[model samples]
Target: MKKIQNFFSGFLIIFSLFFVFHSAEAGFFDWFFRFFGKNEANVKKEEIVLPKYYRLGVSSVGSGTVIINVNEGKINCGNECRKIFPEKSLVELTAKPNDNYIFKSWSGCDYTPNEKCKIEMNKNVTITANFAKKENVVNSQQQSGSHSSKIISSSVSQKSSSKSSLVSSKTNNSKLSNSLSSAASSKAPSSRSSSSSSIFSAELMEDVFLMDDDGTLIDSDNKLIDKKIVEKFYTLHPQKTYYDFLSVFPSFEPGFQGAFHSIVKNDVKGIGGPQITSSYLSDSNKLIGVNFLGFGFTSPRIKTEDDVKNNLHYLVHETGHQWLAYIGKEEGFSTATHYTNWTDTGFIRDGQQWSDVMGGSPWKDNGDGTVSEIITNKQGFSKLSLYLMGLASQTEVPDLRIVVPENPQDQSPFNVHVRGEPKTISISDIVSRYGTRIPSYQTSQKDFKMAYILLSKKSNPPTMSQIDAINYVAKYFPSEWNFVTYGKSTINSR
Candidate 1:
């Protein structure tokens, strides 16, 4: 009986071993590894892979040329006509209307609703900027005069990393901060009419429309879309980096970013856009060789009260673009161009759903082979973004991942459903490639200057309701900027 029992036990042990071995071979242990985040594929590599790039082709109509500028003219098209831009790259196109002809309108971009052509190159596409030979082109945008604030929004929800709301009427000094500030100094900008609508008052520019062959965009209430009202505002207040226009034209699209000039083509040293310096002409201007140009048309007529209330993210996202999501591009991180899965706008064009390109999808590592996208309501600029903006130290940034999809250009990585392999971009590699951000975050400028104006169509007075809305928004904007930056930055009209 003892011999039989031993034989049976040995047989059972052998059978169990064979079953376990077969299960292991068949991926039965995969769940365990995944649960523990110990999958072999989950190991993060401190390396960079080439980013997915899409071709941007340009076609000219009439007499002008569209200057395609990206990466400080790497493919500054129009001697080239067609060039490929990396995924998430912001492409700015300006119409150089030869002498008499004015830029008629851009034909290809369904997203660009204003004269400033800021396109997020998500896929291979061509854009056509049309210039018309006009008998008399009154380009009022070039004409000198002051105008008021205007910005437009598609109203996508956003995520903030901070839980505290700092919009109190009486802001305590203890609550204010200057992050990355050295031991001696860290304070909010003195409230010098900072958030007052009366102080940041937008001068009204009545709409200028052409009926008898001026040939600019004239459809919605005959409001001329070709000449941005804010251009005139720039002529008036050339000092401010940003212009907030309370506009009448509901056709206007969104917040656009630009630089006045770049000394060199190196993106790290304020190349395409400045990260650590102020490029615009303000009282506290620095010749960092880069300046940020932000313009938007916010019409309360078009935007609901909820939209106006929640509009801070749009401002934060666009301004953040001035210094974000581009540093790790060489190391395989794609610049995220406002793609979100939750917003099915349902507004279709060309038989397809709206591109839904407005807010960005920042991501995080789940420690497994897969990564979880930082959803809206939690999506502020990442620490990596802050570092690029000269707002955070290198130590604050972590090992960020770039998702390598099965198909590199198979839609944008912003889509949550898009599965891919996670490749980590280490900070050391970024430091090695770009070198440490000069003037470091400790000494970097955290306060920015902005101008606000109210835009009214010619002969149309801005509604009192509109003025109230703008005032309310402007009042809380500093706190909003403060919150989104996680205390790394602030803005002032002064």
Candidate 2:
């Protein structure tokens, strides 16, 4: 019985070895463990291999300009690109597999065959090859199935390396995305509250200067200085750049033409319009009380009932008159013609305004003689000058001229009784008006020499012959016209 059992065991062992050897040869083990095999069912089938150095160019309809670039190991597109794109909704080009290299389209492209080619984005134009996908095969006219074997071999090697790199890259990218998302979410709440507080603070301030009948917040200089009230202006624009101040002023209202005309005609004299029933003198002396020019600032304290009705207007009007005087007194301002003949009605022009343009602010007088000032006195002149510069779009250099009177006579007659039409005053006309002789007020030798030097320095200053005459007046004619020296230099004696 023992011998029979030993023979059966030996036979069973041999049969097991034979079956194992045959299964390995016939791929029976692979079929049994199909999930782990390298067949189509187990692994992803390879598609057309794309090159490492490749780009996908996209175009769309209704789009202006488009440029995509690979920078800092990332993709960027849209308005960030400097290149301008044609307007389009959809325009795209894709790739296809050939043999060793991928085939790129110059025109309409899709992945599958039999996709109808139609111009949906651009209308009425036949499709043509504007660009190619592959730079190496760009010029080749013919298509071929055969590929460079060396390129294929290199591509396979590169693809293996790419797979490894992609795996590591994906791990890094996943970690980065989580970090950025977390950081943004954490900051969102605090940022939102800050923005809301800023907005609320601004609304509180707008209620203050919301005055102009036109809803405009005008500066003391009469220019539309701000649209929002003072508090809102400072709140919204925490950083006080020139552009911030610019935003406060509103644009000229189109419907207020009649209001502007009435203000110009009634408050300001010498404005060239037809005769009015009001017989206010249009001459220079009457203009003294008229605040043609000045600059100031407004504050919350100005809201007193008395100030609201009268004081504001008085302050505004007076500053306007003073500004007109200053602007007229400037060395080269053609408007000086108006000052030289302050009494002539011809001094007023079609567009000029004494209340609005000159001072920008108009005030009405209360029982108190003291006019309320908005801006501090120190900044008043500078503010007035800035307002004028803004009106004329003057910067760095002012384009205005100031004309001093040669005769210093009162100009309030409303008619021309002088040697010539008011417009006749030119560089040469100044000498004729002065009669080739300097006035008596400029009697200092040093002051006389400085005046001549400054006259020479002006690219288009008064004439040198006129300067020489002015010098003689400063040195010799001491009893006449007690005009102060006009030199920028302060010291009169050598």
**Top lDDT: which candidate number?**
1
lDDT by residue (tens digit), candidate 2, 185-227:
3223111111221111101111111112222334444343222
RMSD over all Cα atoms, model 2: 39.7
Q: After superposition, how far is residue 48 of candidate 2 from its true place, in Å?
A: 99
TM-score winner among the candidates? Answer: 1
Model 2 worst lDDT run, 10 consecutive residues: 450-459
**Model 1 lDDT, full chain set:** 0.44
Provide the lDDT at 89 for model 2: 29
The residue-by-residue lDDT of candidate 1 on 1-494, one tens digit each, is 99999999999999678668667555546755765677979567775443466667787675445666555442323322555556788877776664345677886674665555778878877788887776744323221233332221212111111121222212122211111122112223122211112212221111111111122223454333423333343343445434322222221221222212222112355312443433334434332222222212233222333434454555555555455444443444543333233222123223433221233344444444444443223335556666777887889777655555556664553344344566666777878877777657888777764433444433222333343344444455667777656677876534
* Per-model root-mean-square deviation over C-alphas: 17.8, 39.7
**Model 2 alpha-carbon drift over 4 Å, by segment:** 1-203, 207-494
- Output the lDDT of residue 398, model 2: 23
Clashes of each: 31, 51
User: What is the Cα-based TM-score of model 1?
Assistant: 0.43
